[model samples]
Target: MADNAPAPPPLYDNTPTISEKEDPSALPPELAGPCSDQAQVTEEEGVASDIADKEELPLPPDPVETVTVTVMESQLLQKELPAQENPVAVEAEEPKLGEETELKQKQKLGQALQSLKEESNNVSDLTESDQKALLELKQLIEEALNEFSFSSPPEKEKNLAGTLAVEVSIWGIPLLKDDRSDVILLKFLRARDFKVKDAFTMFKNTSHWRKSFGIDLLIDEDLGDDLEKVVFMHEHDKEGHPVCYNVYGEFQNKELYEKTFGDDEKRAKFLRWRVQFLEKSIRKLDFSPGGVNTIFQVSDLKNSPGLGKHELRQATKQSLQVLQDNYPEFVAKQVFINVPWWYLAFYSVISPFLTQRTRSKFVFASPARSAETLFKYIPPERVPVQYGGLSVDPCDCNPEFTISDPATDMTIKPGTKQIVEIIIYEKCIIVWELRVVGWEVTCGAEFVPSTEGGYTVIINKAKKMTPADEPVVHGSFAVSELGKLLLTVDNPTLKKKKLLYRFKVKPLGD
Candidate 1:
């Protein structure tokens, strides 16, 4: 075998050996057989080949450009200097009187912000955007309180926040109650879009106005019987905000009003009555739950006898100015129902006096759509039946009566009068419907109050009716004094005029 191997090849022989030919199992166990080692090396090589094949994929493209940014030595030195400031100096300065006060104020403001944030979290009606705006408004209010001084020596006496604390009061009435300051400040801030100085100015002016205008007195003052009838607030809207009805129609007797409240004393009283109406509405909101701070107004103009006179317009302007300037965003919405073309023109003229935000709240609706539109914000049950709703509280006292008689042609001679009387034991509504047979005669109607001794004209002005006009003439008056409600019709023409009329009276139930 040695001779054959010697003859086979040099050291680097290319011939196949017996180790490569034999199976690994056929080799001896004890010896480090070349067959087993060769087999193991071959297996590993196969695995390495598979891995190499798998990893032979295309590589990604290189970046388009390479940029290196470096801070200047001076900038780096500036940053390092601040970081190495002596902590002792900072601590020593923080205890100074002014700085300490400022820190306390900041801490207080932080607490207020946190409180408002937590309060906002509990409110279910606010949208995400509203909540964010509210938070910003709260911050602005805190900033205003901290930067500016709202307290005077006198005002500090009434401060709910204490004598040493910052005073937050409007007209000497503390606005910074523990439970409601956040909300109160928010209203002012929101009105001015969080402009601190502007809101502060507005709030201060409002406080002065409230004091001079006797807003506190107005709250307790009785509006008297006459004004109570003119403005009604019996129901609430769908949002649980109170609804105020201003019967512009009932204010038709300009001449009578001029006569009744002509003097300065009476005029002042009248103005106070108007102011009291608003104050009463606000008081309702103040006492209401869930922070209701708005009112829904409805101005009914269906039977308004004439276009508002100059004096009436002036009075309205003054009243609206008071509400707009002082109350700010109190009226959430205002619907003008049965608005005639002339009234629309009047509104257009006066609209310039209104702020854009206030004008945006007004809605004019026709009779056909009045109930439908009102129902959107006011539930059907809350709305009165006269406006085409389901409420029966003050049942439609507008009962129709026919005065037509088949026996006689129901004609009234010239200079003749027809008087009908119905006794009302208590406060009630008197509605009437009248029609003239022909277009020739002018018909006039008036309401009179009867005493046991004599009768007096309650409605001094006689409303004129023509054949072309609506056959119905409806009105309501409160009969506070127990007496007969007398309805009178006069034919002022020379010729005999065929007349037809009907009237209904119903007690005003609470």
Candidate 2:
């Protein structure tokens, strides 16, 4: 049966056949492992084996390196920090070198050592680290002192050629440097060191300190419940006026003084000389309310709170009043009488309109009495009425109205009545009683002299007046109608020929 189809491959089913799997243990070790060799094993594998062995092994009773860490007792790293030192101890520790003797020095040294011991008592509270650092610093300082001793002073001073020399403290601090040209040498002096006694000694010994600089001093005067200090400086001048400069604050270099003195050409030389020769210092000032006007320069006046404004206002008012009282009439008229002097000076020339208004009135009352009286007689209605070709001279009517010899020649135009103002130039005496007369009266004052030419009459008059005397005593009265009017003159000669007069006959209010 075709060998029964070879028994279908021995019933090898025509289906898919299962292959037998090989056990890894049954395989070669090299083939089963991950492509590794026992002789060339990696550290990772050795570590893994070691770990596994360690896991299998039991832990000892105690670890080999089970060491206990104990913190050593240190002065530092403590909870509470050491108390800081009080600086008062330091002041007492040092012996100040001042006006004292050897015994005083020893006493001061003992006090200093006691202060140091008291200060050291607090050192017990400090950390050992801090104490150690302080000790190291002190040792270093001592070493440095031993290396450079204080006893060895140099023969020539170091850094002294250009140093600043000073006799007093500046701004409350002692002056540094020691050069003669230092500005501090020219500043305000302190009484603590540069006492009057010292000053006299310096003045006597030092040629540099001459009379070029004004001496400033304060005198202690005991007043009621208070002491008053008066400060002053005297400037000695042989040729010029000896002026006393006020010592209020710091002494200003005469460089600024040039502005108040000499003309421009001489100012520069004078200022340079002053700056070189004149020496000064800061000074205290004593002042009063009235002295405000005396202030010449004010550059250093403080601007804060403006204390100067009040004083300035009072000073200005007083100055303006004085100016108004003493000025000449012409000059006073030019200046405006304002409340503030500065404003007046500022606005006087600028406001042309106001000036024009003030100057327009011709009736301005003159300060002189003579000039005032002249204006009164010049009013209208006192004009002369003379006809054309009338040459009736008052001088010609001698016996009744004795006119002045060397008579004044007056020109009157036809139908025009102009005021004639005459100024007295000389003094002339004229008889009063005998040289005066009245015009002729007809028909009981009804038929008086007519303007056409009835009567040429004269009264009291004078020819001239003295220099100090002013008499406005002449004018003519005219009648429009022919009627007589009464005339009266205290001085008959004055009415007849007055020395100075003004005549006007126009309608009033013209």
Candidate 3:
């Protein structure tokens, strides 16, 4: 010991040295180092005093000095001691009743902060294009608010666009990128003339309609030859937007159409056909740069005889109303070519039902000037020759025998049976229209299984037919099993009769 160092205190003054080793099991798990030492000293005081008296140690020189010496030695020993091996276990023990609520609060706060950090990370990970789009969208929203008082969105809807963008991005919806969020929102706003409430309503309705209508499924639907001939989508226009042609003149056979679709079931089919046609055209548009969002329509009225009839006009009006209500801002331009003088009267009757925005898209052209006007929007190389341009017509030009005509046609003598074999691999519909030319004959039709190696009748029916019968049969069947669909028709009559018929096979819901 150094000469200047203070004299050491007596070790046995009824105070024993706190054991450096403590029974860890006796102390609470949370107590460590100094706390455990203190507990050990207090608990074993009697044992230490007994040992000291037995040993007969001398008394301390001063009680205060003894206490000071003991405290200093304990602290120094604690500093020199190694760390405990199970500090985590001690910390993980259930907290005291007084600290339980505070511990729980801290844990909850940590969790909340972690969640906030994750959300911030997600927002920061947006691509450059997405970031640009969001900025543009915000700018547009602000512009709408400043320029049009009614266009300003309420607080509830202010974040709606942002929410929708995030959802679409997370879900990976096709054709709906985060970058196009502004374009979609602008469509609703424009449709409602910049009224936020109305725009939101339109947006909601469209979302519901998309779900109910199954537009995504419709994109894959295959339209039959009959519907395809009437409504066809061709090459792109000058602006790179797809062009659709509706040959209204070909629908001159009003009586035939009425007889073919007289029942409510067939009428429903007609409505679906119209909607699917529009959906198909919509699916063809590309949303990338230099691509247009709207379609160009050419309604050919050349040689239309019954378009002026009241029934035809009424049907046209209803069809237009449905299109306008369900699909807004879809048609960029609608050009009517070879418009007859009588057609104007029918147009006048239906034009009043159209919105000003819709009517502004109409462009009427006479037969002589149709090509000149169409050339402005469409290149001469892309227009069909029938419209006085260079491109060849992709469709059959025959008035009676259109693309819907059957693949095979034949004349069957009396007492002869003609078997028609159709091969299909999915749910489909088969339609046939037959007319007896010379005289009445007994016509028998049956559907027989072709794969079983033995004839098993699926449908067997025979009926007497006359020229006035005008028999047209339409039926649908599932083709789960891969096989041939056999249709056997028998003509059992003494006199020779000519059977002029047309049959079509098409996919269901097409």
Candidate 4:
């Protein structure tokens, strides 16, 4: 009879996914795989090294104030890059040492771009095997595109191999456009550990899914604004990656829950909305090889509907499948804050769908540690006010300060009092904002003058602040004399509290 046709290429990775049945302890070491390869991980140790190098870079000190930098763990950190329309790995000129010494501060940012050039989109981030895989994947894609027409939309039915198609693009970048194509290609390669065949399959499948799902059209669709607060893109993480927060508790409202998941149609709409949000967010990222391409995902599970909520679970399952399939290597870290006891069950349900590398980026925290955990990855100033941070929404009426103001974060042990002293040597007015997450403590402020003759001013009388109190304290004082502002926090409960504050001193006559 005849030689059997060569085995058809697999449509998806047949590699067995990590199962809950498998040992779970081996995963979630906070992260073990983010920086292990070039395709992902710039937020942790690898990215930290970038920062460490900057910290070591000899630069002129600031004249106004010395900016304090916080470096958390050296482990891998993540923020997904957005698929930009014209993102490319730029070969920016490097700054010479001691060049523009006075403007050395500008060089810090330049060095960051230079470091990205060294770490990403170029051959430096790749191994011999990775290079080989990349070449193979590129060839396979050329063949597939020539053989199977793939475009953002307005699908072309003709599949001709006369040439490598430049018309086929993803995230608005062509398959053969430039180095950016390689950056996007590496994402698939790394997601499959540089398995050429698997990566090719993933590439094909992603294109196919985008078309089948009409993602291009979906992005422009208006699904409704009800879930606006449920999910949103906020500021960047410590590593400069964009942070996306998912407040699942917002669905706790019965009306919202029913509207989103009451029926199959509603659930489908929610999924579309979520994917739309993700597509929109991804477009905001820079896919330049060395750019922060991955997103930092923080899921707030506080007050999340429990396992009994069949619809929520089902929607989550579907969403996970879509994300895991089409959005490979898009997440830098998957953090679950204020995780409930049922979190294990939730993890178990989705565990089988994720890769070991993906799972390694996971971090979990209970309610008590939620805000603190975030503080490690995200600075207190960059975090949202509702999440125990100084960054207020633009719509809110905080005129004195914006998210740009840097804030100091510290902790006070139980049964102890910590005082923050801001010494003023000039005649100026000071505006300040402070907050203690879970305020089961007492807070007060006082002014002490350098001269013994200066009268002590009690700005805020020491009061026992409870969780019921407003989460933030804002105060302003007109300082005509040189003195020191002392803000004090006293914790009486057994639990420690996170303290965040920022202040600005306005020179007189300004």
lDDT of each: 0.45, 0.21, 0.42, 0.62
lDDT of 2 by residue, 1-510 (tens): 000000000000111112422222221111000001111110100111112112222222221111111112212112222222111111122443632563475586456334322111133554665445434433443342343321123412334563322232221223232221122221111111223233223222222222222112111221121101111222211111111221111112233322322254443332222222112211121111111101111011001111122332232233233222211111000100001112122223333533322232111111111121211212111111110111133453223122111112121111122122111111211111111112110101111243576763443232322323211223333333333332221221111112121111222122
TM-score-superior candidate, 1 or 2:
1
Candidate 3: the clashing residue pairs are none
TM-score of each: 0.46, 0.14, 0.41, 0.74
For residues 160-274, could you state the per-residue lDDT of candidate 4 as single tens digits? 8655334777887777678888888887776777778987887788788998999879988989899888777789887777887866567668998899889989988977887
Segments of candidate 1 deviating more than 4 angstroms: 1-174, 254-256, 259-261, 286-290, 305-308, 342-359, 393-510
lDDT of 1 by residue, 1-510 (tens): 000000000011111222322222221111011000100000000111122122223233222221111112212222322212221111123366745874776586456334322123232455666556556655655555554444434544424653336555542335544435545555565566555566667767776677688776777777567655456785777556678776545545566457434665665666677666656655556522256666666656555422224444344434444544565545555565654333344445555654544344456664433554565566543565456443434354332322111111133444455544455554555554444443233334344444566556465355566656553345556555555545455555444444433334454562
Model 4 bad stretches (over 4 Å): 1-121, 151-166, 341-356
* 2 versus 3: better lDDT goes to: 3
For every candidate in turn, the CA RMSD to the true structure comes to 42.9, 55.2, 44.1, 13.6
Residue 415 lDDT (model 2):
19
Q: How far in Å is the alpha carbon of 104 misplaced in model 3?
A: 84
Clashes of 1: 0
Error of 3 at 205 (Å): 1.2
- Model 2 stretches with alpha carbons more than 4 Å out: 1-448, 451-454, 462-467, 474-510
